[model samples]
Target: MASLKSLTKTLGGKDIWMLTLGKGDAESKPAIAVVGGVEGSHLLSVEMALRFAEGIISDHSDVLDNTTFYVFPNMSPDAYEQYFAALKWERSGNARPTDDDRDGRLNEDPFDDLDGNGMITWMRVEDPTGDWITHPADSRIMIKADRSKGEKGMYKVFTEGRDNDLDGTFNEDGEGGIHFRKNLTYEYPYFVAGSGEHSVSELENRALLDMLYTKWNLYGVFTFGPGNNLSSPWRYNRAGASKRVVTSILNDDAGLNKYLSDIYNETVSLKNAPDSGEQGGDFLQWAYFHFGRLSVGTPGWWVPTVKDEEGQAANKDKNREVNFLRWAEQEGLTNYWVDWKEVNHPDFPNQKVEVGGIAPFVMNNPPLAKIGDAARNHTDFIVKMAKMQANVQLVNLKTEAVGKGMTRITVDVYNGGTLPTHTEMGTRSRWLQPVKVELSLGNGQELISGRKIQTLRSLDGDASVQFTWLVKGSGTVKIQAGASHAGVDSQTVNLK
Candidate 1:
């Protein structure tokens, strides 16, 4: 409940751990990693992450030992502070400032809420030659001008602001950090204004790599983010609505793709974003390609409905608006209005100002009123992911008698999960721990030639890990394979 900054230890000082959470334990069950607030403005992410961690501790401690929940609520805490402090420049990055507009001035003239309505509403500048006109069907929603239809443009939309820089630009270069998501190495859109050329703020990325990747036992990973690349609800080629970006990323791994489809209700689609080519820097891609394990990128929240017009046409479909209304009504939130409002804008003093849109406060960032419900819902999903990560498998165990005093034993280990014993991306990027193979023997009188076996690293799902042991005399031997976070399984065989 205290400020995130208050939950840290003295690690050579300077104050940290304000960005991380969860109490660690040694006993293994099913472990889950909860990541949220990668984008600073997404306050709901941080709130829900914390709320779920507490919920698990308070309500589900029985499974706590079996599952270690690693919670990083605010990956960009520095950026979030700007939001709570009412500073207009709250993007994904940390407190570091960048020249957003490249006009030689850096974050000097950011957008501001001149009206003091506590919202960074858009500013409409009335222009005779503007390229946008108010929608006739819904004045609340603006539509691009149709020159063919002889509809003249009326206004230019701008983020709520004045000519702070005096350069005649409304919000060219605001403040605080480039888009961190754009920083991913995966087919990251190049020459983009905000994607940092290099790994600028390595704080969060490095921490994730060091902690999760380095843990050799972390074989499977499910990350929650904005894009639900794995959710394949329907057909492809739907433009911005379809998951074209994720399709190309997993094209090579058809087996894993199929498995993910089954697990995620087949909502996962395979398609690439038309603009950004294939990416090599994305964390999930790196996890699979480099670490040689199963990994997934997921959007934490899903709007139940996809469209209103489509649903109405079918008469049996659900609309995104309906789902939003359900959430709004349930939480008693009235921040969003379908109706239009009349307000004079400095830029477009004559044009009407209507504030009904995506309802940034509710849909974009659910208020604290709904935080508990949201956190509980997501906690279950994370728990399910943990259950799926456990590769508790019995591959093979064989024993044969060679002679009066010699016998041989062999064991085959298989990782049934999509992820192997270690994350491929983690290993490739030097971000994960090497896969570990351990064999334990009970009775030892005369040690044979090959008694102990271990593997430094491992391949991905469906791959077999083999171990062998020789004995001087006929006896029984037990073997166990253990993976971090994935849990452990064992088997025994008798030799003649």
Candidate 2:
């Protein structure tokens, strides 16, 4: 069964819909949340998520027997809609009014579409004081000056904008307000631009957190956004992982990440992906560090290495814009590049300021035609994760007549799947309920030994512990084990 719900509305009054697919309600089975729009600018994520949901509901509902799915396709609809607005710009924040510069002014010094191209692109101002110069590898792209390489600075780069508030800043603050991507509680970036007054302060962030906290059955999270550890898993840094306030992936979690990362690489055709650098207040880290769940993220697409006239991969410089332009040209994608047109700017009255660059949202997002390949492959990969969900089993049950009326009942409470009952971080946080094992006695049965109820902090995959209970005058005893997120199992035994 599937449930479509509007959990909450964004500050801009956009409905944030989450699709719950499972045997029953979303909470009835172990779930893996698929989140999109972590960065409102990455429009491809929303589509990727949508496709995943479609794949499950249309074809792969069999996985629903064990793994439920909670798909939030577009969490930042306010900023996502900007992609289709009259003036397009890469926006990550929502519509709520925010003083991004902390200057007591709201939406001041917004970007200007200088060339009237209806897109906020880059502006290059030629000046000797500038620390940026045209890339030597590709003249059309810019790279910072390298003094040791005898490269002299010749151009200053800024968004196409003017200092509307006379604050000597160009587009320092804009209509796009607080960001759901930058408003998470873990490693919260306090007083940072685009990160609201406090963590989870934005409506979108608060609503998602509220939903996440209530879902005790969630075992993992898969997000389509910029903070990717799916392509290349982050290595365990002992220093960061050992801190009083843990920052890096814990040892056990890092191993599991490597395990999952290998599966991701195998499932997705995209390769040679750059590591998604760390960003404070991102949902990816929060899902692991604070929320205590297995979380993996991917941008879903990136500029592929372009081929030269000889049909060989060219542009080895690794500069994203340079590589992007190379790929766009090879793919014959038009309007993606705003050919550096000379534009007169009031701020740079006496200087040469050219308005041009890659069009907004093309570098991170692929052409709509190419979205299907990635979406399909990613959906297949998410379904493969069902194999890792914890499964409870009662192994090697043994009963002995210890006395005339007393019977010894023993069972091995075990986890049969590859992943532990709880994540390494979950154990550290201790927020999730432990794997519970209980003995339900029959009529007139009395317990003489062992615990009627016991909790195990965690049970690693293929690991087991013996649980024994001595009962007097038992007709039948039921042994039940597992957590809500972990698969549950029970066995009934007949006592003589």
Candidate 3:
């Protein structure tokens, strides 16, 4: 049976619900934590996580018996509410108030609907010294001038808001606080906007991490957010991985990530998936580097390439905004773009300023119903992943009697699953369980050889390590192997 628990209330008093969707006790089984709403700007990720939870509960209950799922439906509920709020922009933080510009002011220069459309869009100003120009193919989109191509810029772009605080920066300090994506312990960005005063300083950030720490069997974490390492796997770089700060994935876990990425691409098969490379402190990177788990993440959805009249997909290397406009027109998607119109502004009286561009949240988040295949495919992929978790078994138990009352007992600790017991980072972090092979002898029994408890770091998939013990004057003895996440298996033997 599935159960929902609130981790804590967001600053807006929204309940951040964590759902344990599976059979029996979730903590007792190996689990994958499906996290959504890492960034409130990505509303589609929230829909994906919710639909997966619903799909798993209704259709894939049988898979839950072996695998538990901890579903975090939303992490930044405070900012997420802005989607339905009166004035909406792409907000990424929680409700806690902070000087986003760190200028000793709180949201004093927030976004203003210059067009009064009740939505936030871009503001472009025509100026000779500007570094932006209209896209060659689509005048509705803006692109940076490439001096190498002899393109000259004729406009400057900014968010749709004037300098309310007269800081000469438009909408630098927005409503809300730390971005959960940036307020993580791993590679925490210092003094950066939306990175928070310090890492893990926000309530939701602290609460989510604390809850994750308690889940002993959570070996895999799936984060749905801005960064992507799923559709296209990253390569392992020894030099970067060996850095004192560990800037890249370890060699061992890197291969695993590549394998999983292949499976993800095969399962989802979403075309034109955007690979937003990792920045510091995001959940996708933190889960692997800090949490020491098999972590993978993606945006789950992206704008597909528009096809020509002959049904051939256009080259994706084109300007993203122009590409999006073409796809939107082809798909009959409307109201997502704001046409440029001259607006009277206080910031600049002489320059011609216009407010209009692609609407916020429309680029990252598609129509909710468009992701049905994504949810179903992800569900199937995760279910397959659940069945692949490391399983420990005490196999090949044998006992031989010597000429005297002494007897020898032997057993192999084997991992019979696709994934190894511990990830390369998991072993290095020393956070996960270290395997144990223990021998418990009867009152009359005495150990003559081998460690009473043998401990080591890791076990590869389809691999086994043997442990032998010589007992003196033994009656009965019990041999147990393994620890929490990898699982423990025991064997009982009678000695003569």
Best by TM-score: 2
lDDT of 1 by residue, 370-458 (tens): 44555675666555555555464557677777776766777777767654444433444455444455555556535476646575455
TM-scores, each model vs. reference: 0.71, 0.97, 0.96
Query: Which candidate model has the greater lDDT, 2 or 3?
Result: 2
Which pairs clash in model 3?
Answer: none
Clashes of each: 34, 0, 0
List candidate 1 stretches off by more than 4 Å.
1-31, 86-90, 146-152, 187-193, 233-247, 251-293, 297-299, 302-332, 337-360, 392-398, 414-470, 473-482, 485-496
Candidate 2 lDDT, 239-296, residue by residue in tens: 9988999988999989999999999998997886866865788889899999999899
Q: Which stretches of candidate 2 lie over 4 Å from their true place?
A: 307-316
Q: How many backbone clashes does candidate 2 have?
A: 0
Per-residue lDDT tens digits for candidate 3, residues 99-185, read 877787788988899999989999999999999998766677888898998999999999999899997889888785778888999
Cα RMSDs of all predictions?
A: 6.8, 1.6, 1.9
- What value does the lDDT take at residue 100 in candidate 2? 77
Best by lDDT: 2
